[model samples]
Target: MVDHLIIFTRYPEPGRTKTRLIPALGPEGAADFQRQLTEHTLRQVRSLQQRRSLRVTWCFSGGDVAAMQGWLGSDWDYQPQAAGDLGDRLIAAMHNAFAAGATTVAFIGIDCPAIDAALLDQAFHVLEAADMVLGPADDGGYYLIGLCRPVPELFQGIDWGTAVVRQQTEAIAQSLQLSSHLLTPLNDIDRPEDLPLWDAVQRQMLSVIIPVLNEAGNIRPLMEALQQVPEIEVIVVDGGSQDGTAAIAQTLGARVLFTNSPRACQMNAGAAAAAGGILLFLHADTRLPHDFPTAVRQTLDGAHVVAGAFDLGIQGARWGLRWVEWGVKWRSHLCQMPYGDQALFLRAETFRSVGGFAELPLLEDMDMVRRLKRVGRVAIAPGRVSTSGRRWEKLGILRTTLLNQLILLAYHLGVSPNRLAAWYRDRNFSK
Candidate 1:
């Protein structure tokens, strides 16, 4: 005997599920409304199930198991809706729930906005005195239905989409001498006039933008690691990589955008295309540390810091690399500046307001830091992001360190970025 709360919804296809509001919302808006509604309902049920002793399921339509998993997630039980109209499907679902040993089963549609955990609990409590529970809709239909056991007669002989649905069902209950209870009337979002219910509520997402030029070897692991984070959206901005970098990143579920532009320009384009509220500029060969989100959130929550970067951990055994990492930490803390290899992150608004990265091919990171400091302070997260030491391995530690310092010196002394880039290129002439 188990309590099961099921949400019956469509897989959010445009021009199909919520067609009534298309004139006002357009096809894209209607689909977004349905998808958000379904997500909101599932979140509510998932929260309730975490503390209570009940199970949850999504009895969905318009998509198969794989498609549903891609759209939502594979964290809950899912069942395909049976063939026929809405009434037949609802009846079949109820009967199946009872046959599967449910003590009390409640189901609601994606349309209703008033369904909450308390009302669901009330449905279960009312089941002790009543055989069935019905949440009437203001449009004369019903938004929610539940039962302690399968009642075949209550679902039959009633026109489903008609305004007299609730009335006819109540009449049928009276004739069969079955006790029933009516929940509060709800107005489901079914027409163009009801679009204001979803307004001004923001969804916070973090976009992890990685700029790559022929980094096929490092794409997979980086994408997988970022995918583990909850609100992260990984993007691989490729700069004319002949290697299978684009294909590999897409296979690993990271969005890929191509450009022949420099790393700074590619990063800016990726940031422009990102749909997240925050932008985390990562290197293609970098691996982020655990608890990175919490660190970033705490660091950025302060009024002073408008941008932050993770501590640096060079991925190499050479003891000299440890000192290189120390140099980065000191520069970030004392100078309040970090290069892009440190996995810099900032709010999207701040990034845009800073005019984004300059189109310069070199010193773009330092250039952005100077401008960023003018607006607010920068911070460093406790967690570290490990970057590949391939560069250090190619050029010995002393030589590489000297070259970087010389480049920074030249840039500060008013050397043009194009000239610095040409010199930097001459040094990294090999693989």
Candidate 2:
């Protein structure tokens, strides 16, 4: 017999969902928090489903079925929550699950980030002996509730959002002589004070995606440096490199993917294969600081920030390169436009929502930054990503700078990226 997992969540509508956090996170931020929390919880549930015979159902409020499906894809069951208070909805969901042939049913909310596959497995295992299972929240409410069969009286006449929720439920269970199992308590993201729980979870993983072309010399060193960083997934997308770049990256423990030329295509390919929640796009020649993961997380912690990049640090002794770094710093901070070499990072959801990087021959990073600015702040992290200054040194700093400006100006003046790419290639080849 298959068990059923019903997820309780609301469609993340600004000013509607997670209203308690709006004072601190603002409407958009609160909605985004809800979005992230729901997705995080689902990831855990999906993990459990992979190893067990569990059928998943999404019972949501505040948005229609189409909207929910559109936001989260249309693969699973999506049910609009029956209209009522929390207890009434819980009763209806439990009844529906039992009526539909569920051997055991468990209900969980989206607020708890600590509910992983292991915890969920324990909940189901406990239900085999106990009539009921409840995962308590540190706030005195329960994050999860499971039942072997329908027990409507367990949810009756209980205070839904108050501290006495779990207590009252357990008291009811005791009155009915139902044996209940309590899982470990976990903190939920309900108020401003509880936001740290989500932050801690988000800092656990960072996926660095590097796009390279024939940089066998640079790939090994970059991959080695990335290997030293904890809690990171390194993906090297080689653009048909002939200099053994892909082989070197594979040997150095980086997940290497082979894609066609053009940096945009390679980065997008890496992103598609990445499993982490946070994505960092780095140039093959750029080296991130040792604590880059912390820097990335801290910068993205801002309520209104959607994407971020590190400050540029060109590795060279040339005095002109210092000026180049200075200009890049001011532009990144003031204009909120950091080029790809500076190590751009953001939530994977945000990156996908912006349609990843446009597959253009040139100016794809600038286009991405401009599109991201329309959604939220494109922040610059305090730490710097040291990048090779070979381009400037090879073509003379002043000329290269002027050429970059000219290309940007032409791009804004309706120049096609293909033509711009051709002109840029010719200029670099002639130089």
Candidate 3:
């Protein structure tokens, strides 16, 4: 038996979709919110599909099939919403699903951030014994409605967008003596006051962006470790690696983006492609602590903290590395300057506000930290990210330390980034 899940959404055109949120989020922002919400909802649906036998249909308004496919990919069965009120459209979709031989059908809107795979699976499970299942929303409208069979009368005589939607639907079900199950109530994002619900959801989502060049050796392990963290999006931006780094990351289920070789350019590309509200800039060879997601959220939640990074832990037994770690701790806390190896992170909005990482070949991390400090405090998380010690081990620690300080001093002395980059490369190449 085919189980069908129908998702109702708009095309997210700036002035057309999520119009109620325009005053608070502006047209473009509201559209972006709609886009994110729809994508988030689909992610849960996809997760459910992985564990169950289900088919999905995308019922949309305000866009053509090509446009919808372009935005959301062509994997779904796209259907243009029938012309009528919300109730009419619901019935039409439900009728089509049953007509197409679906044994169980569920309809949902992309307004509830709390909807997840488990909740969705439970909805289908309830239909085994119950005639109908509805996920109640705090605003009195239901976020989800599922049925074992088509019940057209249930969609009739209800105020679609009012606070009485769920009440009326339940009353209809009671009058018909139908066996129905109501799931836990959740809040939906609709009004300006509802923005906080979406914001809270965003706080839990972290996008880890790794810029790489010929890093196939490190990409696999880094990706494997990252998969353990929940609610994180991994984006690997490859700077035209010849070692099949992009292919490896893609095979590991990480989104891969190809861009120019400059680290800043690659990082910026990943950020632009990211869908999460929080962005973490990571290195290919660095491994985050097990509790990195929690650490990231807690640190960013602090008052006056606009950006943050983890403490540096180099992977080696050298006693000198302890001194290096100690130096980093003080510099990060006192000077508020933690270099990129510590794994810098901040909100996506804050990153855009600061104009993203400067596209300099040398000292881009320092430049980014300096700019972030101007807006608010840079916090150092208690957790540490262990990075490879190849750089310090390849060159003597003392020589590398001195070279780094000299480059910093030269940057402060107003040396052109191009000149600094050339000099730095020359020094590294010189045995």
Candidate 4:
């Protein structure tokens, strides 16, 4: 039978609500946005609850639960958010709800603006038989998590914000023999760029390999950063870099391979030479986080898991990066998909297993990820890799976002690599 629907939320305050966004929108602006967004989401959930016998419970925190009583009105139930990380709170609420005679329970957040009535209905409908149902967010987290029979194992031992949240949960479920279902995806905006495609979060990940040319000055720092993580293996394919890139690579101990012109060839050569079970084609300027090795190693250890990447950050110390950092990292967690600049990592076996880097002048990453998904799961982790945002800063945000999306569309529609390469060159995006 369908049970209670829990709306997981925290009090919308200036400092507490989405503090990461504060970097871009400031504290007050972020809080105001949170207030409006939460109100909108509550309205949607309220509308959904009206149709079914499903009980609606407000799991609130960061302030008195009583404060939301007036906002939600007298009919709905309100419960304070327990003190703990996200997982602890969720588990506590679910346990309480079940103990209080709820046979099935569903939990959701207020961040996904596009989540509407129909999706929530489906989640309830599916839970009648399924042990669990999840509405996978484009950012990697689930918008709605519903469970009919309690699977306590599902709630334990996860890197909550990492790409492995869903995968890890699924593993626990399988090990316990629980049945589950998945709903169509929805986007949750945690970044400024997300404001545009907030509606398309359900779509799939498009892997795009970006090759670096004459990046002699940038290569070492990036390689050194990658090496600190033992799980990641560096493969540098130089297109005869005259700036002593090869010599530098050898000096730093990165596996350097020689290749002819074309970033595609370089990437393909690098993939051919990569020794790790997964090949990560990173640009010379990118800097990944410290925990990436553990994340990638854990992913490789999973069954039906293929390839993935981390969230994006910039190379230097820019205060403006705080927003990008939050946006990229949160989006990676919610969507389970990472950007190429995040230094994409995949099973080395899966890389060769799926025929590594396509010889595409542009959008090779997109091409490869599409193939990778078919064999297993791909994810975006909370860990971040810093890339050169100089191109975006110079080209203008609107212009760069537009150009890349257009190229992405063209690539997905099967545009010839050569033609896209021509278009890419015209844009003059610097490495």
By TM-score, the best candidate is 3
lDDT of each: 0.80, 0.86, 0.89, 0.69
Worst 10 residues of 4 by lDDT: 201-210
Q: Model 2 TM-score?
A: 0.57
lDDT of 1 by residue, 69-111 (tens): 7666656678999898777888888888878789888888878
- Count clashing residue pairs per candidate: 0, 0, 0, 20
Which regions of candidate 2 fall more than 4 Å away from where they truly are?
Answer: 207-420, 423-431
Error of 2 at 118 (Å): 1.6
Better of 1 and 3 by lDDT: 3
Q: Judged by lDDT, which candidate is best? A: 3
How much lDDT does candidate 4 score? 0.69
Candidate 1 wrong stretches, greater than 4 Å: 1-203, 429-431
Models ranked on lDDT? 3, 2, 1, 4
TM-score of each: 0.65, 0.57, 0.75, 0.47
What are the per-model C-alpha RMSD values against the true structure? 6.7, 11.5, 4.7, 22.0
Q: Quick one: ranking by TM-score, best first?
A: 3, 1, 2, 4
- Candidate 1 Cα deviation (angstroms), residue 73: 14
